[model samples]
Target: VERRSASFALRMVVHIVGDVHQPLHAADGVDANHPGGDIGGNARRFLPDCNATNLHALWDSGGGRYSLHWVSTKPEWEAMRAALLRDARQMVQNRTAVAAMDPLRFASALETATWEEAVEALSMSGGFGLVRQMIGESAGIAESEVFVGLQMNPHSFGGPLPCPDAAYFANAASVSTQRIIVGGYRLSFFLRHIAARLRRQGLLVQGGDNVFFGVTNAWEAAPNAALH
Candidate 1:
């Protein structure tokens, strides 16, 4: 592959891994209340007052409005960005356990990720597994974190449901950040493992660069952005 293709591939892997960490990406949010299926909360609102107003958007954009969800306001957007990077950094440094997860799914995803199927199905299928145990893990988070506010009130699907409280955002942020941290760890591990195999076969150079998503330097870089 050309350098650009390789680099693009690497970037896509990093981006997709991050994308999957968003809880809603792994869940369809179907139940008796939502007979039509939540469609990853796209049809619903996050809260009666929250800008996103949809459960899926809430998790996808980090407590903000649509399109420019996190960018509704410059100051608030910057703050969210800073917090995201800071928390992700901390989790990356502390998420050593994630690397030990057996049979990372990136291999399979990567295999199919680049391929263009000749015959496209009417509807794509997805609802657990096939994501390096990520679907299973995220399902647990969706159950606990996303449905948390629901326990406080009586509503379902689209509605004037109560807004999630400060406590809820805190929990969501933590979960999202930690998942990204594990993502970086898994991505790093996958690349290194691949490179090592190539080196062993005398196909490439040794001691290749470790792809740093700025998490490793969080301590020295964003000391003020500590977990809250």
Candidate 2:
């Protein structure tokens, strides 16, 4: 039960960490049309011609390439997984995309460091500081990139805004792809840090060719033990 709970918690943490790296998740557009705030652009609707109905949805979907859809069957799941892996590989292989995030410098540093070293490298903030820095960076991108050419009118009779131009879509796609790579790397850093701590506490063990979490030397004696 403890192992299952730990696995669930880790999955939630990874999901949330990836979400915060999305610029729209960290910012709300505020203009005369929405002095109260744009509710992260959800209040600002785009024309029907646009890929998404609102600015928030546009950024969330990466201009429709990442739009949400249901996948219930095993085959559907497998297909989605394969598509995701292919896209990830393609992004990693793209020199411009990988260079934008500097994965070699940022991800490699934390990924290679011990837990104590990571804490020291973060100036003792223990990863929270790094998460906050990521949020700030996303907010900056939201302002400069996401909200730059938005045309919000205060008196449009609740009508939708104009569809973003091709340039806007292009930039959004570029930024979203880079942020996705960075977020994945950041999540890896956190997982590696947690694994290091678990190893220190003897809750994780090096076995053959695998690192097993939520287990100790006598893990084989326990049934239904988590493997990671």
Candidate 3:
């Protein structure tokens, strides 16, 4: 079973922590297995102005693109990074062992708990806290790659969206396969957008590089997530 797979379990950790934080992820609007294929708001076109599919994708990504553009300049990056590192250090330093780790356990232990409950526990657990920490670490790498690439080859910002560039696409066979991976990509992209926005505001200057920003206002923007 998928739940039994180690990789699946790990992905579950990554997803669930973020998922439960999403209000819509916790709500009950669409069925997972349906003829309409409207799995968790990813499907279900709604109105003329809103694209549920697109909106849901944005929320899933955690506002990544927006954050990056806002925080693009040099001075912002330096300040944000310094603040983020200091905060990360202080947080980790004072954390208790129990508060800092949530070692992976066999799926059997999760049997009694609902998926939501397990996720909440993991979010509160030290290991999951470490997962949050790693977000900073990984974000640092992703941002550095983007920043250096931009400095060496600056692109003229001429688009509606304030992104460093346009977009990236991928393809896959089978609905399940497509949805499974696309979910991660969508979420990652939105987070980058959020980082870009924070950069613009200078709230996430240095920390922006380390912070994983993404859209998180799904419940407020339900109509938007239904298109396409």
Candidates in order: C-alpha RMSD to true structure: 8.8, 7.2, 19.8
Give lDDT tens digits, candidate 2, residues 99-153: 3565234454574677777766544455545656777788988988999876677
1-228 per-residue lDDT for model 1 (tens digits): 443445466556556655666677777766666777778766555455665566776776554321344367889878877766565555545433544542444433442332222011101343333453665677677777777765333364445556677777777766755555555554553345434443454444323553323433322322222211
- lDDT, candidate 1, equals 0.52
Q: TM-scores, in order shown?
A: 0.58, 0.75, 0.23
What are the lDDT figures for the candidates, one per model?
A: 0.52, 0.65, 0.32
Q: Any runs in candidate 2 off by more than 4 Å, and if so which?
A: 93-100, 103-112, 117-128, 154-158, 199-228
Clashing pairs counted in every model: 5, 0, 55
Which pairs of residues clash in candidate 2, taking residues 3 or more apart in a chain or in different chains? none
Query: Candidate 3 lDDT, tens digit per residue, 10-86?
Result: 33434653443332343322222223433433433223332212323433433221122337789997776565444
The prediction achieving the highest lDDT against the true structure is 2
Off by over 4 Å in 3: 1-8, 30-38, 44-53, 63-228
Model 3, residue 140: displacement in angstroms? 32
